[model samples]
Target: MIVLGVDPGSRVTGFGLVEKRGNRMACVHAGIIRPEKAACFQEKLHLLFRSLVAIIQEFQPSEMAIEDIFYAKNVKSALKLGHARGALLIAAAHCGVGIFEYTPLEIKKSVVGYGRGTKEQVQYMMKMILGIRGDLHLDATDALAAAVCHLNTASFRAAAHHAGGYAK
Candidate 1:
C-alpha cells in the first residue's frame, strides 16, 4: 500500500510518501511546498492546491493521511491552517484517494511512543524507525510520521480482524 502524508501550513506545506509491503515500509518521496512569500494569501492557497494536485497525480497514492488542526493561540493562524488543510483535502478528494486524519498527539504517540514527545524526540524516532540518514526537515518528518501512524493503525485493524477481535 502507498500512502501520502501531508502537513499543511499557510507558508510551507510538507508532504511525504511511503510504500508499505508486508511488514516493511520505505520512504518513496518527501518534500515541502513553499508558496511565494510576497504573494497574496489567496494566491498562496491556489499555489498549494495546484501543487498538491500535481503531487497526488504523480504519486498516485492509495490513501492520504493528514495531520488534523490543533488549537492555536492566534485565531488568524488557525484560520490560515484551516484554509491550507482545505486545499489539501480537496486535492486528495479530486484524486480519488482515501483520506484519514490523525491528531498531532496520536501521530506522536504512534511514532515516538509518547503523546507529549518533543519534536527532537519524534525526529530521532523517525530516523530510527525509517532507517533514514542525513538531516530531515521537521515538517517533512512530521508528515512521514503521520503516514507511518496510519500504516500502523491499519495493520492493527487487519490483525484484529484476522483474530476475530474487534475491528473497525
Candidate 2:
C-alpha cells in the first residue's frame, strides 16, 4: 500500500510518500513545496495547488494521511494553517484519494512512543525507522514519520484481521 503524508503550510508544505510491502516500508519520495516568497499570496496559493495536484497525479497514492490542527495560541496563524490544510484536502478529494486525519499527539505517540516527544526525538526516530542516511528537512521528516505511523498501525490491524480469520 502506498500512503502519502502531508504537512501543510502556507509558505512551505511538506510531503512524503511511502510504500508498504509485507513488513517492510520504503520511502518513494519526500520533499517540500516551497512557494516563491516574491509572489503574491494568491499566486503562492495557486502554485501550491498546482504542485500538490501534480504530485498526486504522478504518485497515485492509495490513501492520504494528513495532520490535524491542534489548538494554537495564535488564532491568525492557526487560520492560515487551516487554509493550507483545506487546499491539500481539496486536492486529495479531487484526485479521489481516501483521506485520514491524525492529531499531532497521535502522530508523535505513534512514532516516538510519547505524545510530547521533542522535534529532535521525532526526527531521530524517523531516520532510524526509514533508514534514511541523508539530510532531511524537519517538516519533511515529520511528514514521513506520520506516514510511517499510519503504515504501522494499518498493517497491525490487517494482521489482527488475518489472525482472527484463522482462529475462526
Candidate No. with top lDDT: 1
lDDT of 2 at 3: 93
Every model: Cα RMSD to truth: 1.0, 2.8
Please, what are the lDDT tens digits per residue for candidate 1 over residues 4-57?
A: 989899998988898999889988888899999999999999998899899988
Please, what is the whole-model Cα lDDT of each candidate in the order they appear? Answer: 0.91, 0.85
- How does candidate 2 fare on TM-score? 0.91
TM for every model, in the order presented, reads 0.96, 0.91
Task: Score candidate 2 by lDDT.
Answer: 0.85
Residue 38, candidate 1: C-alpha displacement in angstroms: 0.6
Regions more than 4 Å wrong, model 2: 163-168
lDDT of 2 by residue, 4-87 (tens): 988788888888998888777888899999988898877777777788789889999988888899999999989888988888
